[model samples]
Target: MIDPSAPLPRPRSDLTEPPDVPQVLTGALRVLQGRLLLHVSPARVGYFRPQLDAGRSGLVLCGPNALQQARKLRGAEQFGGPLLVDPAVYEVRAASGDEPFPNACEDTFAFDDPLAVSLAEQRAVGVTAPMSPTGYLHAEDSEALKAAVRQVAALDDPQVVFAAPVDVGWLREEDSVRQLIACLRLVPGPKALMLGGQMDPLARHPRSVDHLRRIVAEVPGAALLRTDLAAFGALAAGAAFTAFGAGSRLRHIVAPGEKAKTSKNFSTSPHVLFPELMHFFLGKTLADRFAGAAAPVCGCAVCEGVRALDSFASNAGDRQTRAAAHNVAVLMEWLRTLTALPSGRARQQWWHERCLAAVDRYPLLNAQLLQPNGFKVPPQLKRWALAAPADEAASARADANDYRRS
Candidate 1:
């Protein structure tokens, strides 16, 4: 059982950046940072063994279906770290078309459920507080929010508290932030904030970022947990931590009542997530860009091994694993660079400079950068943008060198 009086998980060090705790698949764990968050489903519980054997520090987040399966298989006892239960209330609300607030325990997983209690007994389990589907947060919602909080508090013992997702826009309003803080106060243990909805809107909105920074400053203890690539920005802005799904599509929030379809193509492809451009490119695309040159596209062990074989494409599973590893590595490096800066303003300046440099190096990404829905390049980034024609050859050379050294 988690101690209610204990403080929330703080950044291990102020001098160091928060850890890149990627929510990865079982296979990708070997190449990711040792501190991980395993996104497990009931059907995939068998894959848990390898991760445990790797002796990595991690948390197991049981998906909705997996929670049910875990009860039947007694999977919680096998995990070495905290076991989290994702109530997946969003799915239930969506399917049932219920109002977002005043969620009933019968509609979602209860912390006091026999299986949940059992899991807590062996290893504390995280309780995901119910969230709203419409992404609305206001003073009026306090009563309902309190009800949801009471439900989790009623549990005999829960290791962590995950606040339900809220609209990103809410952060823009001081009243909304205060209302949320009120709700968070109801949670007695370590807490995390889940940002609901597609992050694209927030990524391109400077005001939202400013508001988010304020929220982080105000609540230094609560970690930000997002299900999108935008987590990079959140962390750079001072979020205690962030996480994203292993799969590319898992980067977006699924609305209530929305049904998710599994991809027919199970084979994964080699790809890289370019944070500067906020886009992903398949290995073939990168290969085309570097045609006659030896481009160090990725430096991860998996990518390096694949490059040695001179095969950019391979089995789907292998491709997915390699791509995930490469993405995690790149993200980790970026976080380190940002954290090493002297102050928040310096970090922002560095990010702006990087974004500008990326645009100059890859003119092809210009359209995406300028898109209305694309990343809102900060004023500094715009100021540093190319004032004249970019030197293609020079840019290519720099890119190659960058990859080679990565």
Candidate 2:
């Protein structure tokens, strides 16, 4: 619960007025290794500032029910000037009539409301497009969707990235894939796409590499591919820039099955995977595969001379938040490392070895936990429930042989 008694971070209005600062906040975002975009909530904003100040490249201000929080974020002191301020206003419900979004368009929250107007007025770098919940946008009333798209397009800024449906929904059914492909083609302007590794059960294993390879090849611009650190390395071997998601994993940090899931701030715990993910992604594991000379950059703190994952993981409510920060910090570190590498071969070598160490490490930990007389499974797993088993047919969806036979 928010502390009503606590003083507000800064006094700001909820009105759609002009911003105090307007200019593509930073010049090159060159300090960031690869393009780093953060999806921030009101509560987590404080934690994110350290990374932002460290060298984070981009920002996505996501406001769900807390409209006032969004206003405060825009007016926050650290980001007062020409920073790229992307606001995602979500709350639109299904309804009749062609307003700005589809009748059922969940994407139609309030991007055009006062906050949006304020950003525009300040010329505080802004994108008109709101981040639509990935899977929910599909059933959105077409009129509303189009109107939202048009509004985004009309903005002077570049195209607002829309998350890819397949990655978020894990669209494996043949028809679903077809529909998603069509949606991508319909997206306005030079749009960026997002894909997730875990979303596709086959992505992490050997089975779906070829399909993922094709998807990467087909998508245009530098699209955002949201996956775990390990899988991100796998994809980076094939392309230049990729966007991976970090914060989602925080949800699983302290499974009741692990212990009693803590009720404090998430930033304070170590239940989810640790700093190892970042070490491998940036320092050795995946970076080794890119034989090409020009590897892309990541934006976060770990690469900015902070090698200690334990430092960030030391305090947290659940391990998930710890993992989330570690993930962001490390990705930034990895990007910085990428920028420093002179040749593709060196980067590839770094990634390969790092992955080898990481791959070797995780199983050992799992083995120790599963030992005959080890600690009992935590209650959180039982309470929240173990992830449902993967679909029997999931593996088949990525069949290389399917394409060959056809």
Candidate 3:
């Protein structure tokens, strides 16, 4: 959420100089190989620093407050090289501590503001707009969309990543397509786009894949596209896909008890689903298919293991953090495998199967992790996942009334 009311941060146009993207990304890749992309809240920066030294490539600081704290981590004391700041403008005051004194110190910042144009003012390796159809899909939001693009175009960042279902900010696919076309006309050079979808294996829908393909075809500068591991087989026929990161909330099919429900930290929590549940939800056969496509990833450690699908799953724990880590690990393998294959149908087929195998094994591990007694999460996460029981009808009704009135 972008802070609509706070005085906009001063814009630095000097960043107008095109950043050395390839060089920066290459450096980033070297660090990310076999390293984790750790994310930390403003308060937990201390806890994650040690992990950074262990094998973290970088960290995404969630709010302004977090970013402020991260400023202290510069130089050798910090675990990773660069600390990314993701500022949400629509809500609370920046959780960031005191602002950076000299101003040139901020490393990475992800701005999600519809009204403020300065987000695009900062020159970055990339900039993107996340459009989705499910939640907040209001056509009236297009004005904000245009403003966002105008800012991005103004910045003229060479690399861009378009994220998600395009229909969320537009009236329909056609309108969204038109808007994207218009945007590309503004910033037509080198860029990348990634398609995102929340998978529900038990309740599969054709619309998911259809929408993904439609967007991929329409969105300009789209180099990489993504979908569920189950759907990757179909997507692989045409586009390359990167595995989803740590924001999968309500996407799990087989976690245990309260863990199955959505929570505040779903986007940030490091828990993994149980292996058994992942098997039932994603299936072992699928895992084999993906494993067969195993490719080398520059920054992930999960893909290094070469073993049977079941054995791999066994090694992955059941908590959400563990499951997500395993998924990334396997995705690394798929990437490496995909990159290694010769340009041939046979090579494509091999890569496809390997990805499927890895995908299938995730749900089972996620399921086992959700059990109340299974994986022990931090106190903050445990409280965050707490949900009111079904029996709390009176309290629910009261809360509903309060929400409606508010």
lDDT of candidate 1 over 182-210, digit per residue (tens): 55545544345555444343553345554
Query: What are the Cα lDDT values of the candidates?
Result: 0.44, 0.37, 0.34
Cα deviation of 117 in candidate 3 (Å)? Answer: 8.4
Model 1 score (lDDT): 0.44
Across residues 1-406, which tens digit of lDDT does each residue of candidate 2 receive?
Answer: 1112322212226524322211121233222223445545556655555554344244444444334554454555535421222232212222122444323223445554532443343243223233333222333233333444445545544334443322233233333333333334344433344332222233333323333333433333323433335234433433323444334532111111123233244333432333342222222212222232222333244334433333333333443454455556655666566546543345444555555554455445445434432222222112112111123125545575688889
TM-score of 1: 0.57
Q: After superposition, how far is residue 271 of candidate 2 from its true place, in Å?
A: 4.7
Q: Arrange candidates, best TM-score first.
A: 1, 2, 3
* Number of the top TM-score candidate: 1
Maximum-lDDT candidate: 1
For model 1, the stretches where C-alpha displacement exceeds 4 angstroms are 1-57, 60-83, 94-143, 150-158, 172-174, 199-201, 204-206, 259-271, 275-278, 282-296, 305-317, 332-361, 364-406
Model 2 spans with C-alpha error above 4 angstroms: 1-33, 53-56, 65-76, 80-135, 138-159, 163-213, 225-246, 249-273, 277-327, 341-356, 364-406
Q: Each model's TM-score, in the order given?
A: 0.57, 0.49, 0.43
**What lDDT tens digits, residue by residue, belong to model 3 across residues 1-406?**
2223322212235434322111122222233222223334555555334323333234544434543465455433543364444442212211111210112223434343331322343223121221111111123244444444454456554433222222222322444444544454354332233232223321233233333333333433332222233223322323322222233431222211122344433343343322222222222332433454442222335323443233322323543343445554544444445445543344336533443444443444435444333222222112112212223435778999999999
Query: Who is ahead in TM-score, 1 or 2?
Result: 1
Model 3 TM: 0.43
Q: Least accurate stretch of 10 residues (summed lDDT) in model 3?
A: 93-102
| Residue 354 lDDT, candidate 3, scale 0-100 | 49
